[model samples]
Every structure is written in structure tokens, then in C-alpha cells.
Target: MASNMGIQIGNAWFQRKINLRPQHRGVHLVTEEILRQVPELLQFSVGLCHIQILHTSASLALNESWDPDVRDDMEMMLNKIIPEDMPYRHSCEGPDDMPAHVKACFLGSSLSIPITDGKLALGTWQGVWLCEHRNNAGSRRRGFILIAKMASPRNQSRRPFTVCIEGNIGSGKTTFLNNFKQFNNTMVLQEPVELWRNVEGMNLLDLMYKDPGRYACLFQSYVQLTMLQLHTMKSPLPYKIMERSVYSARCFIENMKRTNVLKEVEATVLEKWYDWCINHALIETDLIVYLRTTPDIVYKRMRARARQEENLVSLEYLEQVHQIHEDWLYHRTLFDVPAPVIILDADQSMEEMFVQFEKCKTRIFERCRQSERESRLLTSPVSSPKIGAASE
Candidate 1:
């Protein structure tokens, strides 16, 4: 058999809002100065780096770097073209602010540079130019957010990176999602517990557990509706971490039928709803993290923290629920999980579990970026091999 063609994969996207040291009022060659500071860029094969100046006064652009006079001449021409004396209306912050805006308009406040084989894909003579429009006679302040994403060939549209956190009840799903909330490029969509509890002031979970046969169908329906909402939620950022999904609801109701808590009729109705909704859901998860724990551990945690809704939860019920999760997620006895599943040993101390959470968290983000880079490599336009200095 022919060997599968290998692709370079690693971290693919990184965004950091950093301040470059202030420079005197002039143009400067900051390609090396800025790149050396970003180690994440060194991991990918080919991508694009975006530098955006947050401040209106400063600007970023690509220009001649081989000759020192080129930058000096450019700065001189900028002063001549947008002369400070020309403007008078918005001079509140002295003469600099208004003229600064004008100079910035020509130079621009953002630039995107292509990366080839982990280095800036630019002409031998090209370099990154940071133009300081304000008169920073002494004080130089940094003001820019540099974002680099693996660029696909001709822009093959890719969905946002997504993850579904899977675990039995009280397995620290919420806490795990909270850990990733610090990422500016990541969004967390939690389970709609509040909506389920106060549906017309009727505690669905509490009522369902008290009378499983009576409320099983109603509970499953609400779960299916809410999980669908989570599945179809628009991610505000490039990365989304969903607490639970429609598949879990399906498994839960399936177990309810197996144990006779939900009759065959109720289970059939719930399964049909789940199958249609899950198959029709627009967004699919790229990865699933299964927080695996024994029923005893889960039950201990559940009862000790006695939420009124879960008061009816018993060790016998927990065992069956745990088995259902294993059968669906690991054994594949039920529906097939579409994404890769990573089983985490969740029966550890809180401190130890958190440490594991960080490891899992890091791996998920790293893999997502690597996948993006690989996709870009496949469709990217053919180009001559890059040579010479690092940024060239």
C-alpha cells in the first residue's frame, strides 16, 4: 500500500495584544524585533500573520528594508504630505492627534503577511514597517494586537473549532469550561439548566426524578430542545466549548427506557426527536472529552452537594446511567460518536482533576490549530521555495 503523505502540523493560530517599545517619530524596521517575540509562529508550515495597530495614530505596513534611507525618506514624505499646519479642527491633544490620523490614513493601521514554511513569505527587499505618527520625542508605547491564522488555499471556508464536554452529572463539566474562558478567541456555551428548571416555574428535572414514568417524556423533550439550541448556537469567537450536546440527551432517555423508568412508547418518541434534531444540527463537534468516573464517585459527589433536583438520584440509578455513557461513548453499543473521544480519569482530587483539565484544555486547542494548518497546506497556491533571512 502507498504510504499516506505526511503533512506538517503544530500550533496554527495565535493572537496576542502586545505593546512594542515606543520609537521616535519616524519609520522603523521592526520585522525581526517583533517576530522574535512570537514563538508560536515558528510551529506551522505556512500561514498569515495579521498586525493591527489599536491606536489611531500608529500604523503598520510592508516596505523596503534593505536600505536605511528608504524608511527615512518615507517618513519625510509623510510629514510633507500630511503637514501638521494643514489641520485645525480636532487638535485637542495638541497638534499631533489630527495630523497623526492623516498620516495613519496613508500608511494604514493593519497589514497581513503571508508565511511560507514557518517564516514570513516576503520579497528579499521587503520588511515590516512600524510608523509612529505622533511625536514620541522620548516616550515610546506599544499598541497592537498581532493575530496569525493558518491560511487555506484560496480561502476554503472552515467552521469554527468546536469541542463538546461529556461527563455524567456532577462530573465538573462547568468547572472545566470555565478554565478555557480566559482565551479571547474562545467562547463557552453552557447547558440550558436555568431554562429547564424554571419552565413556567415547573422544575422539570426535580419533577421528572420524583415521577419518572409520569414526566420522562416531558423531560426528554425539554432536554432535546435545549441541547439543540446549544448545538446550533452561533459561536462568538473562533473556538467554542459546549458543555453538553443533543447526543447526551439521546443516551439519557435510552437508559431511562432500559430501566423501565421510561416506557417503550416514551423512549421511541424521544429517540425520534433526538435523531432528527441531532442529524439536522448545523454545527458538529471536532472533539469530545469524556470525563470518565465510576458511579460510586459520581454518586458521592452528587449526594454530598444535594441540589434539590437531584435528590432522587440513587446509587442504583447512577450505575445504570454510567453504563449507558460507557456503552454510547466507548463501546459503541448505541449511536456512533462522530468525533474523536478522549477518556479522562475523572476520579481524582479536585486539585489533581484541575491539573488534568489544564492538560486536556491545552491539547484540544493545539490540535485544532494543527488541523487548520494542515487544511491550509492542502489547498494553498504553489509557490517557489522561500530562502534568505528569516522574515524574507
Candidate 2:
């Protein structure tokens, strides 16, 4: 839909998850199957559509749609490349299982296609393919996240400049947010630790710490929901600061998966929800203030502060958390950094930390001011030039 001012409306972004019917061990054309489920695709004029298959045994691709022989040949080629009868250790499921994993990795799991005039801008011979590697796989789930520029003025004022304080467990994020609370036009939101400690008289945080294998999923689910709420909460102030974010929760999930605390299915489900919330909700962070501290330093701090729930927190756990944070925010290897990061040495004293905070404060204020200017520019009406008027 176009507005009276000749701007596109109501189709800026769209997301949907669909199930593809189970297929044999072959590459099959699924372009129509996907498009049928997402009729909203027609609403987009120009944008990019990203389709991601959620299974490790099945993958997605764009390839020849005209001939069945092409699809068969592709599947045959993949099997030859990663044959099933190899010396594989991960063969508990079946011979095809390990090879399926390898095949999915080779073919990849997602596709990004350009949208033009309410249609997928694929070449004449191109179509989407679902390369099902397993012979008896269940229905495959795929998520579609799309974005298109709207014709409306980009009024960024409604969206405040959000900063997420990220760090290890005892890296003084609460202290950092506390120091900034004195600033005018800034809204400081601390993490809902109290909520986690007493969720309807159940100490979820303590339970997870005590028996992670039993309650890790339950604890993390609540945490993800609460973090999502914080991220999407509205504030009248121009600058919004949060103690942590959904992105950090994703990092936690990754660590849990790596440490075998979360089963693959459970992790995949959480990740799918994360992807959906990030795309569908108003959760955007402009900056990330990472309080970088070594595992040993934070372990000492945790022991000193000595919360009962964290009594079970060992230095080994802190080390794993530290490495995950480093890989994410510092090394930039594990996951996507949601925003630009400003690493601060958090192993310093309160006085030194305040100095670092002051520097970050300057940057935040500048971003807030810039957002205000852009809002004003977008909202201000354009003045018509006077016709036949004398030149100044």
C-alpha cells in the first residue's frame, strides 16, 4: 500500500515460520510450497527475504527449478562428496545421520533472495530447493525474515538510543547503570534479578545453579522472556540503558549448548524464538558497553559479594562465561555483535571505573543528540518555494 504522499506503507518488514512436508533423500523444489505459506511476500515492493531451515539434517538452496534431473543430480553429487559408508564416530543414529550432518553443512541452511515488485527476483531458471538428506526425516521448519524500506519518513525519535551493558557475572554492570541514573533524559533499567530470584516463590536462578541439567531450560526460558520485555519497554527519555539484553541471553544459550547443558533440540527451539523476537519485536541496541574483566578477577568479586545463589558458582563456570563473552563481544568469533562495542577494563577500582564511565557517557549523549536532530528533520514539514517571487 502507498500513502497519499507517494510512499509505501504497511510492508516494511515481515516474518513467518512454515513447515515443509517431509521429503525423501533428495533435493526437491520448494519455491511454491514456501511462497504459498507466506502470501505476505506479495506485499513487499523491494527488499531482501532470508529463508533459514531449522534442521541440521536438511538444508536450503537456490538452484535449477525446471528439471527433476537437475535436482536428482545435485543430491547424487552431494552423496558422492560426503558418502555415508565412511569411518564416522557419530553413528549412533544411523549411517545416514553423520553423512546428513556433513551434507547439510556443505549445502548450507539458508537463502537470501532479492524482492522486486512484490515478487522474488530470481533468475528464470532459479528456484528454492530443500535438500533433505535423511531418508525418513520429519517435517522441516523454515523461518522467513524480510525487510523493505517504507515510503514514510524515518522518524527515529520514537526509538530511543538504547545501550546494553554487557559483561561477565560480577563485572559491575549494576554499578555502571547506577552511576548513570543521575543523568537527565536518561532511563536506566537494571536487570530483573529479583524476579528471577523469586518467580512465584520459586528461586529459578538458584535452581539452575544447583541443578543445571534439570532446570537449565526452564531458567533460561524465563530469562529470555524477561530480557525481551526489557528490550521492548518504552521510555519517554531519549537515552535508555539496560543492564543486559536478549543478545546476551543468546550468548548464554550458546555456552549452555557447548557445555551439554542444553540438548540440541532445546537449543534450536530457543534460538528460533530468539531469531523471531529480534526480527519481530522493537529490540534494537545502538551501543554495547562491554565491561571486560578476567575470569579470576570476576571470580574474586563474585566470592566477595557472595550471593547465596552464586555460592555454587565455581571459577570454572566463570571461566566458561568469560570465554563466551570474549568470543562474542571481544573476539567477534562466536555470534553477531548486536551493536558497536566499547570495551572498558572492569578489573579497576570504583574511581577508575567512573573515569571510563564518564568517557562512555559522552558518546551516549552525542548519539542521543544526533537522534533528536534526525527526528526533528524528519517530522518538520517541507516548505514550498514561492513561485514568481523576487530572488533574495
TM-score for each candidate, following the candidate numbering:
0.57, 0.57
For all candidates, the clash counts are 2, 0
RMSD of each: 18.4, 20.0
On lDDT, the candidate that comes out on top is 2
On the 0 to 100 scale, the lDDT of residue 385 in model 1 is: 64
> Pick by TM-score: which candidate is best?
2
Q: What lDDT score goes with residue 20 in model 1?
A: 60
* Model 1 ranges off by over 4 Å: 1-158, 381-392
TM-score between model 2 and native? 0.57
Tens-digit lDDT string for candidate 2 (242-322): 998999998889889989999888898889998998889989899999999999999999999989999998899899999
Q: 1-392, model 1: which lDDT tens digit per residue?
A: 01112222343456765546568888998887666445345434468888887777878889898999999999889888888887479988879778888888877889988876556788989999988888863333454577887653222144678899998988888878888867756656677665566454366778888998898899889888867766664433567788888878777887887888887777778878877876676858899999888988989999888888888888888888788889988797877887999889888888998899889988898989898999889989987667763654
Clashing pairs in 2: none
